[model samples]
Target: MTGILRLLTARRGAGRLHWTDWATYAYLGLAVLLMFGPVLWLVLSSFKTPAALLEFPPSFLPMTQKEVRVEGYPQPLPLFSVTMEDGSTRELAQVRRVGLIAQMVDPKAPGTTVRVAADKRQPVREMAFAVSNYTEPLAKYDFLRFLENSLFVTLIATAITLVINSMAAYALSIYEFKGKTLAMLAVIGTLMIPITIVLVPVYLVVTEMGLVNSLWAVILPGAATPTGVFLLRQYMLTIPRDLIEAARMDKASEWRIYARIVMPLSAPALAVLTIFSIMWRWNDFLWPLAVLTKSEVQTLQIGLNAFQGELQTQWHYLLAMTVVTLTPVAIVFAFLQRFIATGIANTGMK
Candidate 1:
């Protein structure tokens, strides 16, 4: 209890910035909720029933049809008086409506399985749950195929990015040569050019290279990222020149020095780049869409769009799939968070 209190007090202390700090923290919290509240609501709605989902007074925890069915036992069923076609009132024994089923179920049997009669006149509208809404999307669309393709592209691209970025950064930071200034300028210059500006030319090149509809279309283009190279170069510059000199004195080859010394010393920076590369490649949508034309080759983000068609969108299954998709990124972030923090601390200044 004291530990909890201490933690709360610490949080409160951190939140306070004189008198203005409280207001700043309050504003930040509100801004965060404003951005994420809708997303939270969408995720919550996935668990709700169809009727409750579209209900006016939004249900917090909508009841399911399964709740009504207890094996060989029935609760005192509520009397919903329905007017018959003959204009006479009749109590429904078990009409099997949405969010409702009439059955004599056993409540006392602890482990007994309950059975509900089907193949009768089942009402389709006003379903008690979002089961169909969720399952249909996975079955109807090639969602799993898309997930596999997305993983393939992201893993390959991340691997390529790591190799290319590390080598280029080593060259720029450690090796002095002609056009080095021009090379740095060129890399930095790309920051000014929006990717959209080169889309047409890039498309033409990819099409000519016969790489369209292949994972290479996504992987190859993403490998030479200027941001990755630039970030790595700055970190590499922090490596002490003495280490390289010592390595040379030992008669070590350049490759040996880089492999044994530079690589070992660059752990924190590599961790930072690994996290960034994973997120960028995993959640990437636009370029993958432009390059890959085959339905089988589409990534998760594009596959998500395919789930949203002209007429209908399955919010429930889509939200569930999103949760599944985001799990990996969350896991990676949680594991590598310390390394990322260290990288930020060392950026440029170190």
Candidate 2:
């Protein structure tokens, strides 16, 4: 009994030490910084002012440094105005105010000037916290409409993609038929074809179908992803043939077996496909940009274009809007991180 307990304890301690090794900690630390570093900068910069934004070597937090302090009373600066000499009119001449030490010295009272200098340092401009920085100019853009359109397209694309790709994948995975290899070869062959080469053709097809500048143009193009079909088919092929046969013997139709048995079993691969679909659709800028011409119809990716002018770009407003635009995708990815994990775990089971 004593020998067995010692062996078990040694094994457990060895396992613990292995997992907590320096290499493991190093990898973990690098992974965390890669994932969260940019996000930290974005959240911190969102609350900063325009001056502080451009301030070199930047302060990450809001400016709390005081710039100006008043002792007795708030002295408002005088506004100078000039008048024409043609009418022999007198006018206030423009001049920069001198430092407090020089003003107090007054040539006649140089003694008091030293005392005044000792009493006060130049006032620093009070640190201005512009909450409006994060709020104001950001309100000027039409992100709500962009967000709505993006949501509509992403949801529709994901659902339709899952359905269509799963059906195609199921057919490719289970059934043995003539021309099967030929069909798959053709499918895979198209993967190598550059989308740019097909751009004009796709545009014409949409134009012929009267889908120009419509939501359908964006949603429908991505509904049938070749990669999703391929990934799902490969994963589904790993399902045991006996399970599928048993389902059919129990009076289950192929579609029902697919829905009830195959889909549930293929969750990891499906998850992988789902992540890819969401990311691709979400990041789909070019196609949506090509399809959507009106600002009202534009997607989130194109919202950045709204603030950009031919000669100038609004950096501060652009940064604020970019932070907002990135937020939802980040949230979605965070929630779906499990899907990516499973996808990686079960990538090549077959």
Candidate 3:
């Protein structure tokens, strides 16, 4: 019994590390890298120049261009630096290339051209940022207008969603009525049907109502999502029926009870739905594309499509605009993430 108690109570030395601990930490490190690696790359790549972007092995950092003088060359050559054979570095300019060997010009002297190894010259690049990537797109493309459109749509849709879904949930959860179970089941049934199945019909309805090309076409259809109704209903079910009864005993109107008592208690769930609604409205591309014909009224996601043309894509500008588009979503998630945890924990309690 003493031996068993000793074994059970034994603690490892503070300095001693276990293999399991190491493995757990390694796994966590890898998980974090996997999750955040692309995001880090995206942010860094947004600052890279077009030449740096096109380099064979991609550079992780942003770079700037510099002009260097070659003795025989009529004009200064655009040269980047590279580490050479003896671990020394040289500034080499790309002139032209044959199948394998690249014709490089030494910018330091005129009439100095050499056949350097192909793809071997790294541009003598300094850490550079092209603010123009963001500025030009915003100024030329009217990205601010699209951003405003997205914000307006997201806020209005989210507010309407919360009010309508909460009301539906309150009615279903608290009130005793005939066919209540069937009604709840019907709400859940909508979940099985993919939104794609209803896309054409919804669009047709919007067109018939003459709401095509209007932001309302986007906002009105999704104002009361079945998923929101289900989430709030599940949460509202956890609220005590007695409190609602007590409110009723005070002769409180149903709307008064819901607005004052239920909405306050269900705040966590509301926050979760708010985040979801924002993401939905912000990232929605296809429907907005179909409904919104004019560029002035489009969302940020639609505006981003302008960066791609028939012949070429402006990846730098696209990436910078992408970063701008993501900022608001990140801010919203950061602020409300705590509520998500609270909602899940409280919902699980009942």
Tens-place lDDT per residue, model 3, 180-294, is 9999999989989988899999999999999988999999998989888988888999999999999999999998999999999999999988998999999999899989999
Name the TM-score of candidate 2.
Answer: 0.75
**Model 3 lDDT vs. the true structure?**
0.86
TM-score: the better of candidates 2 and 3 = 3
* C-alpha RMSD between model 2 and the true structure: 10.3
Considering lDDT, where higher is better, how would the candidates rank from best to worst?
3, 1, 2
Candidate 3: 10-residue stretch with minimal lDDT: 7-16
- The TM-score ranking, best first, is 3, 2, 1
Q: Is candidate 1 or candidate 3 better by TM-score?
A: 3
- What is the per-residue lDDT of model 2 for residues 54-162, given as tens digits with 9 covering 90 to 100? 8767777655333222233254322222233344322121113455322222222223322232123232233455667557654667677787888888888988999
lDDT of 2 at 229: 81
Which regions of candidate 3 fall more than 4 Å away from where they truly are? Answer: 1-13, 64-66, 69-76, 80-122, 345-350
**What TM-score does model 3 achieve against the real structure?**
0.85
Q: What is the TM-score of each candidate against the true structure?
A: 0.73, 0.75, 0.85
How many clashes does the backbone of model 1 have?
Answer: 8
- Highest TM-score, which number? 3
